[model samples]
Target: MAEKASESSNSISLNTVDGKIFKVSPTIANQMQTIQSLIKAYDSSRVISLPHVNAFHLSKIIEYLEGKSATTVSAVKEFEAQFMKDLSLKQLKGLLIAVGYLKVNELLELMPKTVAKLIENKSVEFLRKFFGIVNDFTPSEEAKIREEIAWAFDGVDED
Candidate 1:
């Protein structure tokens, strides 16, 4: 029991691309596939470096991993709702990529689904802004594209 408690208390250091270091328990770190693989490959005492993940995304991913194992279904649902509500589209996209790379399946599924909900009933302009995608089409080309997908523009939110 003491060994189990100590194991739970044991922390691993994660080094992000922005030179930020975060210490998390082995339990939380194991949620990320990349980190799990690294832990297996190297000594747990070593600080794992994630060159592609930024601090913001890493922290959020850690937050999700730490929160996801709640005993109650309602608590997890509430936490997940707030977590999704708190992130902006840009943050969501960044997190999606980071989670995808980390292979955090729950977060990988959640972020994209949240993004899809945000995009649902939104305009082309809204999508372009949300995704940081450039609208390079000529007026006529855009018109044709819109015409082809007229249903997408219907029932869109004004905001």
Candidate 2:
């Protein structure tokens, strides 16, 4: 019991699926809604196990939380730009799901903005390919959606 209690005190230990433990500061842990809520209401004698988050994803989440926590608000905009720059589209997509699960507001905000920027001038094929989202709609339906946002298709290299 003491061991368990100690585990939850200084750090909310996350048991990742890869059989790894991620020990993060309570403050950093709180940046993740799942962890924050767990620590807030837990008995402090149980590990806040995250069976779904594998070690790799957990590591990235923790890194983001720690970096965001340490940065000043004034510098966060710059840091946000650089942070998104470092991730590939695949990593960004994975991070999007992870950060959304954790409900990290800053990450949530930054990620969508980055995705929006990427798609703002992208071709239909480019957007679909980038997100791996199939154009499931029938041709008519697809054309409707596109026409609704017709301004988006204004400029492209397919000319």
Candidate 3:
């Protein structure tokens, strides 16, 4: 039946905030909670507009979803590691926001854990530099805060 044929079709179009369109399979689109909900609420043929996610992040998320179904666990792990390695901090942050918005649980966990590992044992100055955060505290205020948490600085890994 034509209805059955149409029901079996898995293609879904996702329109990004910047107007970039990605045609993805149901398996890939289902990886995103937001997209999955949209598909469930509307026709699969409809172009689901994601107002918050950009094309670059959406593409990367799709890439991740596509790679996640690898036959071997090691292959998936390798792909995920390489994917994280390929992204800069800024890109990672953007991807994290997109992943969070899309409710990609695996990526949400993996990305934050990766970022935490990168920042682990790093000094406050190093964190400030890596995150591009300005230290708004005055010297006295900083010294007090540092003194309160002096133990955090001890045993830090060398940069």
Candidate 4:
């Protein structure tokens, strides 16, 4: 009986990369499918490790998870808008990918808006550099990508 009780009780701790342990509920853990499967599949009761997610990002994700669960929808949206404003493009991309994987709706909604602002009114060179996209295409292909999004690229300075 004690073994069974201990087993059930041990499943909720999430180990982040910076050595922080997040004692989350199984139901909340289930909200992250990646975490849910790892928990369900693992035999041990020790903390589940999240290597890809660093401490800062993990803490933010936790805040997002807890915030959404506790707050009103409008409040969550407002917070997300403010939150994305402070994050760098690299952090934004990471957050976008993480939030996308976690299936958190508010963060997911903010990603496109953030990306649009970063790329809007910028040159192709800026877009390429911002996204770390190498110019694999030939000059013809470059012309094509630009011609394809003429409206999106219109009125932009040469880059």
Name the candidate that leads on TM-score: 3
Please identify model 4 stretches exceeding 4 Å from their true place: 1-11, 101-106, 144-152, 157-159
* Model 2 clashing-pair count: 0
Each model's C-alpha lDDT?
0.81, 0.73, 0.82, 0.70
Backbone clashes in each candidate structure, one number apiece?
A: 0, 0, 0, 0
Model 4: what TM-score?
A: 0.71
The lowest-lDDT stretch of 10 consecutive residues in candidate 4 is: 1-10
Give the clashing residue pairs of candidate 4, or none: none
Q: Model 1 reaches what TM-score against the true structure? A: 0.76
In model 3, pairs of residues that clash are none
Candidate 1 lDDT, tens digit per residue, 33-85?
Answer: 88899999999988889998998898888777777775477798889999999
Model 1 pairs in collision: none
Of candidates 3 and 1, the better by TM-score: 3
For each candidate in turn, the TM-score is 0.76, 0.75, 0.77, 0.71
Highest lDDT: give the candidate number.
3
